[model samples]
Target: METNFAELVDAEFALEPGITYLNTASLGIGPQRAAAALHHGADAWTSGRSTFAEAEAAVDSVRRAYARLTNVPPDRVAVGSTVSAHVGLIAAALPEGAEVLIADDDFASLVTPFATRHDVKLRSVPLERLADAVRPGTDLVAVSAVQSVDGRTADLTALRHAAEAAGARVLLDATQAAGWLPLQADGFDYVVCGAYKWLLCPRGVSLLTVREGSEDGISPHFAGWYNADDIWADLYGPIPEGSLASSARRFDSAPSYLPYLGAARSLALVEELGIDAIRAHDVALAERFHAGLASLGLDAPSRGSAIVAVPGLGRLAAPLADAGIFVATRGGRLRAAFHLYNGTADVDRLLDAVAGRL
Candidate 1:
């Protein structure tokens, strides 16, 4: 359960000395490369050296990076500012009275967008009952790839098969699972993620991937000039009718230049490190942490993913923070997430901090 790649990858992060960060699930530590790319983009924009073409190129890079990571075609990836915005668009595009199934424990971003829609009937079920809850009337199934609170990953293959059998589409929010886990585009009709979390980038940029041919079912309800096939021709010329881009770009939101630049760099770095290696390191660290928790008689909801949620440890968050270990508490559990930058030393620090308090 030792980590061999942590030191090499850890140097890329700007984490301070003597402090442990176990909250990648909440927000990833921004890498120096991403920061540099963001600063460079901002400088260019302020200096009037940045052109529309460069901005478009930056967005294209982000799309391509995410496409490569998810093994999807670049054209299938759409850009958004957050998972809620993109998923909200999908929810709005569904037929009126569409029945959408969601897990009660799923992140709010995955469930709220559809639940708030008056036209859509939302059904909430426990994670264990999701497959059973899917029926002929289910039009869509929405869930996070990894449960935010407990780091429990869904059986996507089983869920996708059931959804397909029931004529329902699957939408996955991959915010907590993308960088540390291997996410394929085939099992899901739509995959959305905010860049601030496991993507290791700044806020204000997200990836929304639409399966080919599935876009036809989703209306571009939030379409803007960015969705147009020819922005200049549609706006400046004769106001050409029906000028929307023919691909998933039709679902893209207006771009944020700096955030896109930073996201592109961060995603590129993730690719360079290789997702398999990152997952291996993360799982190893999580395994060690889980073992330590078990030895301390702590109850962990699940293991194997980057996150480990220990029940009854939520109250120790303040004490852990005082000890210079950062984690997240949700639903009365303390969530410790391991990333490429984490190692056994971090797990040891967390265990030590908790043992001392106990």
Candidate 2:
């Protein structure tokens, strides 16, 4: 009945009382329903009365839910425990002996997969150099919409065009940028992100969206029984030829059904809020967090649309924890992230905690 996009959004999620959680960037605290869903799923798995058919159905629900969220076909959205797992799949699928272009400031998780591959040559190009990085032989141009640490949003339009001109594919690691910007999966051949962050899902569930025609020639190295279209093949015979489903389902590697079910419930909640509303909500919260950090004389390096990074604020990390404020300090900065569920009280609590520590 909630038609208004603004009214449809609810910030009051079931979270622990007396704890100001501001680190949604690292790990999202799920709504009470997501936790409840996980409990029920575990109960089902443990109960001898339940069948594997039921569990598989739950996994399909997740695929459908995430497909709606990312605006891709359910068949194209593969489930993964971590973004790196899916990234490894992409790296393995790249044309043999083709160069993969990565950003100089991309997350290490995104970079490590390409760098470790012997067949793929990794070139860590600066954001400014991205336009020039694409060449005739380039296979993939991979970068995050926003730099994870510094919050630098790159020119996706330009990057997309550049890659297309060179007959290369584009991959976006939207782990940090998904909930903050308009995610256009049109230009990208592949897009992967973990759900625990802005999507407000529990950890261990990641989403990958591949454009309809983009995955035509790619083959998944991480295949399982579920990847086969005739999973219930008692009628058809054992692993029929060409039985593997098309789209992203072909990449499913017996994903943890329990976590996927939990993630599905959480993503359903995100759909109720709608991504555009979430983006506006998160950016506003980040602005408030940036202001709060400034008031406390702490410097937020790379304060962008999603995160507020306070460099050398590790000293404040423990103190803030002692004061009942939860945040993450990584890479030499105290990191505070906000989502739709966080409010001014949360921001003020963090500011006051830092002030008290000082």
Candidate 3:
């Protein structure tokens, strides 16, 4: 049976004629309409046509669009630059003198912010030991839903139960898993992701979700005027009392208006095409790539997400590069990540390029 990948691609985006874009988890190729939206917003800013009203609408639209994608209430999502930017918000929300629990191979962005804090103790545990590693005084249990390098998917529901049992809040760095898996809103206290990876928006823009009631005692470290509910305030006056929107909006600083507009356009396009349909298409394409690589006698590791890793053929870099193939390597494995934009042709080309080197 021919998988539904081609139909899904045809419905959403047409490829750039001859480019085989299979590294989407590294940086997604944004949709053409989204690129146009970004350019239009940039042109407005450059020409002095940018207005407060337009910026406000664009920011709100992007936040709501990300909220819908993550299955959360619209008010609970915030806008940010990258996944790391929002992790600072999570680190601040954590109780003082608290310890954070994380898997050993989690993305560094998720752990680096907490590591810099002297008051918060960092606890790094193995992925296999995470369920048993939660301690009594852990204030926040931090983890990546999918490891960016290895593509190992953590069981969020299980981790949530363990953390809640230990009286700890759950912070999920889901950049690698967003758009590839179905995320349940209630399963996390906080979650953050960059749209560049799989959502195919611009690189700097990201999404953050902080569950209602879970963020009661938290405050934004980097406060701004737009963080206020009555955002249209005269800057000439004394800083108004900080009623920071009482939701996830409290966490965001005033972001540049253009990327948010582009992100909203891209997110809306994805939703109209259907997220589930996108996941199904990508999953099948990944499977095809894996099978073809195996037939070429390359041994790739079995991971439950969109990324596949195989041992690099003993420094087989120049040969593959000469053949016009691109992939990343970590822990002795060459990594190939795919999104809905890729198809069988990209996979076959990769296999042909790497066959002899391995």
TM-score of 3: 0.91
lDDT of 1 by residue, 86-167 (tens): 9888888888899999988889888888878888899999887888889998999998889998998888888988998999
Error of 2 at 326 (Å): 1.2
Candidate 1 has which clashing residue pairs, if any? none
Off by over 4 Å in 3: 1-8, 11-18, 234-242, 313-322
Q: Write the per-residue lDDT of candidate 2 for residues 1-358, one digit (tens) a residue.
A: 4336434344436566788888777877787677888888788768855567766776777778777766776777877778898888887777668798888868987888888788778888788788787999888888988777766677888888888899989889888866556677656898988777877676777778878888754666667676787666624445544777766777766677777767777777777777777777777778887877777665665544777777777677776777678888777778888787777788888887777677
**Model 3, span 277-310: residue lDDT tens:** 7777677777887788767765565445788777
Top-scoring candidate (lDDT): 1
Model 2 RMSD, rounded to 1 decimal: 2.9
Better of 2 and 3 by TM-score: 3
Deviation in angstroms for 337 in model 3? 0.9
Q: Could you arrange the candidates by TM-score from highest to lowest?
A: 1, 3, 2
Could you estimate the TM-score for every candidate?
Answer: 0.95, 0.89, 0.91
Candidate 3 residue pairs in backbone clash: none
